[model samples]
Target: MSFKNLPLLGTAEIIGALNLSPKQTASAANLAHRVAQSAWRRQPPHKRGLSYEEFASTVSDCAWLTMFEFGALLALGRHHEALLLADASRMVHHSARTDPPK
Candidate 1:
């Protein structure tokens, strides 16, 4: 598929297109979360994971949810809450990386 077609799609749809199983989907999500978290924890911080840009470009439904939640918190001026969400997202990422599904 092409980048232009991503926004119109969802994760399940993508997985379906790729013929991936539920376990595979979960595993991939976990793997991606870990990678994103590691980048976020870097000294200078990294622009990785399912960021708004990446979601928009790649049409990742999960990333879209995260970006929406983060943006909503920021819009409400809940900086602390947003940070917590970010930290949580990072933790999930780490979990996925360290304890991948079988």
Candidate 2:
């Protein structure tokens, strides 16, 4: 299944999936930071009307979508697709911080 076709989960569902103990998920913090960074990178710079909380929320949603796509690709045994998603995610993150969207 393509990532786009994957169902969207609520915040509660996402949090539930990441319910592992801190020790069991040593990279959780890093993953979260990267996701936030990615979202900021993808946000458009001209869109200045959004408050900080709104901007963060939008970024968080994008990060979650990317993660969902990544997981879906993996589940479909599409390693190449997963890699592409990962690359896109990284690009979104780096670009947002470096270039400022729009």
Candidate 3:
């Protein structure tokens, strides 16, 4: 899937939360696209054992959840962590591929 298709890719709300300028937002979108593309190619170590369909689904789901986590962190004034979560691949690689938080 294209990173453009990633959940909440370039919403105004996210832009505001991050206090991104127009140029910064564009740069961020490009960075997200690059990160997603790289993750698709490498399948992160934990995800390597999965079949193609599973891997795709896992990444998609994680992307969505990470957006929510990003928002929450921002709301909690956790700007630093939110910025890190902005890099979708970091969570995709470290978080679960299938399991949701309990």
Each prediction's RMSD to truth: 12.4, 9.8, 7.2
For model 1, what is the error of residue 11's alpha carbon versus the real structure, in angstroms, after optimal superposition? Answer: 14
User: What are the runs in model 1 whose C-alpha is more than 4 Å off?
Assistant: 1-59
Clashes of each: 2, 3, 0
lDDT of 2 at 39: 59
Better of 1 and 3 by TM-score: 3
- Which candidate gets the maximum lDDT versus the true structure? 3
lDDT of each: 0.52, 0.53, 0.57
Tens digits of lDDT, candidate 2, 17-99: 64534332323333444545565567687876676456656555666656654554454456797799799878978888899
Report the lDDT tens digits of candidate 1 across residue range 47-93: 44555445345534566445444544554456798689889987987
Per-prediction TM-score, please?
A: 0.43, 0.43, 0.45
Question: Which pairs clash inside model 2?
Answer: 38-93, 41-96, 45-101
Q: lDDT of model 2 at residue 102?
A: 75
Residue-level lDDT tens digits of model 3 in 24-100: 55555555555545666786677578664455456554564455446555555678887886765566566766668
Selected candidate, larger lDDT, 1 vs 3: 3
Q: Give the 10-residue window scoring lowest on summed lDDT in candidate 3.
A: 1-10
Name the runs in model 2 displaced over 4 angstroms: 1-59, 100-102
